[model samples]
Target: MAPPAQSPESDLTLPIRPGDKPPVPLPTRPTMIRGFTLACPVCGTRGLFRRWVNMVERCPTCHLRFERIEGHWLGSLSINTVVSAVTLLALVTVAMVVTHADPPIPLLLGVCSAVAVVLPVLLFPFTRTIWSAVDLLSRPLAPGEVDPRYDPQELAALAAERAERDRAGDGSGSGLSDPGPRTRRSDEPRPPRSSRPHDR
Candidate 1:
């Protein structure tokens, strides 16, 4: 069957060209934060999750893998540990300052233990998500670096082919030509643009 006609505003899937280097990683704090919010190391328009807690198979905007590998989330556990520890310490400090009363030694120890245990469980998922965001933002963008969810070799090959075509002057067009500002369709309320760091 013939393909459907594409609207000017339709999402464009640009082929990675050979010789074209992977996007340069953003260096500044703002850029890094933007990457995290965007859930894209490159551009930030992509949504990272299909649903709460379930990462999308691939980035809707950049096509990067949401979960780069099986068991990759183990790193997130470590992140959670650190975040929980920090939070517990801050909370305890605040509690001590606010109470100003010396609690029994046993009571203080019990409180600390309970906070440590409960905090990790409460914060694990959040920390894991944040870690994923951090990883997406900070990873280097070498030409052959593949999105972990996809075959790096295949993507590299594809990029090489595109570079070859571009060098040869095959007129398949360059990156997505700006389609102008998007307008809302009649049936749907436009989703609010996210202000998250990765959403740059």
Candidate 2:
């Protein structure tokens, strides 16, 4: 299907390409906040999630490997837990403080229970994305970590990278530079001159 046309005035004119390298994430604060909006931290695009909590395996725009690895999202569990704990505590604290530290037990119980159930579920996607951003930033995607579809391109990029590294003396050893055009005499063992024929 054809994409919808964009007006020239639209932000579409902006340059936001992620480049060939693994995503260079924005600063830490912006990165984490991007998660709350369910934006792909790599490209700042909100098309990463298919549903509220249903994340696409890979980013549609930059093709970043979202999961990165199996069970990598376990970090989000910590994010959710911490956020949930803080939320529940904050709510409880406010209720008690408002009621002179003696808020009704039933009211507190009901409210906390409801908030606990709803907050986690509602924020699951956010925490997961947030965690993903943190993880991505901490472990900048290397060439080998890219999606399989990008292997050819990444391999080329990697080769270029290694070449540059070798040039810069970052590799184990530098490559020998070409010594100009080869002279046949210098390049090959001169065949024994046909001494007998030449003598004639």
Candidate 3:
């Protein structure tokens, strides 16, 4: 079947080419916080999920692809499992402490079973976002992974850094606002002098 016609804006939202850097640097604290809220870790733009179990393929604002790599969802599953297990453990511990004299075995079992069934589902979206943030931090963006046009701040920074380099005239300049392109060395290797030079 033929695909629907794409608008110019939609065309611009293409995934960054492999090995390309993301438009802006990923902030650790903010990303984690966003993940907890089930928002896009890169842009913090909300509305990623259409339903509790369904997540959009990419960030609506920044166009950052949620699944950055193959088998990325595995990380989310691991996170969900850990969180669910921990929650169950805490609940069991609290129940044991509260009803020390006669721990209701049947009730505890039922509660644990319910939690085992429900908690993972409830945490599904959250785990996905959290894993995205974690993976982003662990595996830095590659080239062409995310478009830079969406990030004005980083673009401005890059422009300023280039201007600084131009002003320095020796390819020596520091990134003013954020981590950016490496400064080129002032002393570049020159071609060897000709051995047969003579017309003096």
TM-scores for all candidates: the values are 0.44, 0.57, 0.65
Task: Give the winner by lDDT.
Answer: 3
Q: Tell me the tens digit of each residue's lDDT in model 1 across 150-195.
A: 4334555678899998877755456566779988789987778887
Clashing pairs in 2: none
Score residue 196 of candidate 2 by CA lDDT. Answer: 64
Q: List the residue pairs that clash in candidate 3.
A: 16-144, 16-145, 17-144, 19-142, 19-143, 20-142, 20-143, 20-144, 21-143
| Residue 93, candidate 1: alpha-carbon lDDT | 80
Q: How many clashing pairs per prediction, in order?
A: 14, 0, 9
- When 1 and 2 are scored with TM-score, the better candidate is 2
Candidate number of the best TM-score? 3
Q: Mark the regions of model 3 whose C-alpha exceeds 4 Å error after superposition.
A: 1-25, 150-159, 162-200
- Select the stronger candidate by TM-score from 1 and 3: 3
Candidate 1 Cα misplacement greater than 4 A, ranges:
1-31, 35-38, 104-138, 142-200
Q: Point out the higher-scoring one by lDDT: 1 or 2.
A: 2
- Candidate 3 residue-wise lDDT, 38-127, digit = tens: 887777889999999999998888888888778989989998999999999999899988998467999999999999999999999999
Residue-wise C-alpha lDDT for candidate 2, range 1-200, written one tens digit per residue:
99998778886565656764444334677667787788877667786767777888877766877788889988998888898999999998898889998999998999999988998888888887788888877876665555543444455668889989777785434467666996686667877866565554
